[model samples]
Target: MYPIIRMVKQMILHRNDPPLSAMGTHVSHHRCWPWDIDLWMELNNGRTLTLLDLGRIPLAHRIGLISVMRQKRWSMTMAGVSVRYRRRIRTFEKFEMRSRAVYWDDRFIYLEQTMWKQDGECANHALYRSAITDRDGIVPPAQVIEAMGADNTRLQAPEWVQGWIDAEAKRPWPPMQD
Candidate 1:
């Protein structure tokens, strides 16, 4: 069993969250795979952003910030997602991703993320909701949530996100179908 003292220490030290861009370096490219374009198209379509492509930049930043602030390990499970694409982003283009915490409920954390092209134009943006879970899928103790102030009750979908979702729903499924 995990020690209570260690849990308390982690809660106190790692709970201070930071913006995702502050944690790691930007990524420029991934080798061409047959599905690369499809994946990019999906991100642009606003359904859900794949975690794999989120990369170490955003992940390291968010995890590091949360660890530093809460002093504990935060295991995350994706709950929901929404994304918008402002411009076409290709496979080899250099890009940057920025993310910040939007809110947290007793059992969930929400984050707003944006991806930008080398020219600094918005390529895509997303709202990601995640739940905190243990390796065995157990929820964290109440004391941990209270210590982190993870009691937000005012979460709402942003206006731009609604628009993006609508637009994506209307997009042709297969490019050739249009």
Candidate 2:
């Protein structure tokens, strides 16, 4: 089941936060609940992705993207993601999540997120490719930014991010045919 209640809690917690720039980072704290663990008693890999929402949505809200989407009747969706898991998170353990928009291109917005242990070690890191869509199809990042009243100028992505983007382009879609 999706953690809807926790998402609401995060929304309410940061409801009064000041708006941030397009590339600004949003930080949120969370705990690995018993229900969030796997049979081996550590945070489930899938649950980690779900928990990322608790930070990402608030991030969109703080950056005014949610309001823009609402006003334009648009929706945001994840197109792809790459995650690296390092440290283990035990049940009842607390950690901080950081999410930020690294940059955007003609088609998608690239985001980087990290989960940090209490000891300050990075437990996991992820890069996300997201798209905004309307009734017709995917909306360009430039258009989305303009609608959000943010500067539409293009920002160069970091070398590593650009490398990932380049690599993804070579991946065959609708993969694994017999």
Residue pairs clashing, model 2: none
Cα lDDT, all candidates = 0.49, 0.96
The lowest-lDDT stretch of 10 consecutive residues in candidate 1 is: 23-32
Candidate 1 on 1-178: residue-level lDDT in tens? 2234433443444345443333133332222222435544433332225432344223434444345334655555666676556777664455565555555445545567766767779777667665666555635434334544544234554566455445656877666642
Q: Please estimate how well model 2 matches the true structure, expressed as its whole-model Cα lDDT.
A: 0.96
Give the TM-score comparing model 1 with the true structure, all chains together: 0.49
Candidate 1 lDDT score relative to the true structure:
0.49
Candidate 1's displacement at residue 131, Å, is 0.6
Top-TM-score candidate index: 2
C-alpha lDDT (0 to 100) for residue 70 of candidate 2: 96
